[model samples]
Target: GRQGSRSVPQIIDDWGDYGAGVGQVAASRMAYRYAWSTTLDLE
Candidate 1:
């Protein structure tokens, strides 16, 4: 989640726009934290 956020600015710069994909990536990573916390195998 934090890593995704860190890359956001770089992604925005690379793509030359603040678009939906960046938001999706960050959101997905944030959600993954919950899953990882709940399951040892996935983690």
Candidate 2:
């Protein structure tokens, strides 16, 4: 088992907790999924 690890900036960057207004969440989610799928040859 590996111990968890994260610096403050790294944690904040991954958390995305700051206010995301409008369609930000959907847009970000779509972008992430699209990029991931394409990179993995799923799309």
Candidate 3:
């Protein structure tokens, strides 16, 4: 799943204008994952 998900952003990033959009989406996903893991660690 991780490899597949990572490839998706790379494909989007190759689309010129969509590169920035993909970066934002990837950053948001990373932040969400970090927050979720932190919450899990707190439990």
Model 1 global lDDT (CA atoms, 0 to 1): 0.75
Model 3, 1-43: lDDT tens per residue? 6654657676666786677788999999999999999999999
All candidates in order of lDDT, best leading: 3, 1, 2
37: Cα error in model 1, Å: 0.8
lDDT of 1 by residue, 1-43 (tens): 5744656677667675556678888999988987887797665
Every candidate's lDDT: 0.75, 0.74, 0.84
**What's the true lDDT of residue 17 in model 3?**
61
Candidate 2, which ten residues in sequence have the lowest lDDT sum? 14-23
Taking all chains together, the TM-score of candidate 1 against the true structure is 0.42
Better of 1 and 3 by lDDT: 3
Clashes of each: 0, 0, 0
Residues 1-43 of candidate 2: C-alpha lDDT, one tens digit per residue = 2478667887786566544543688898899999998999953
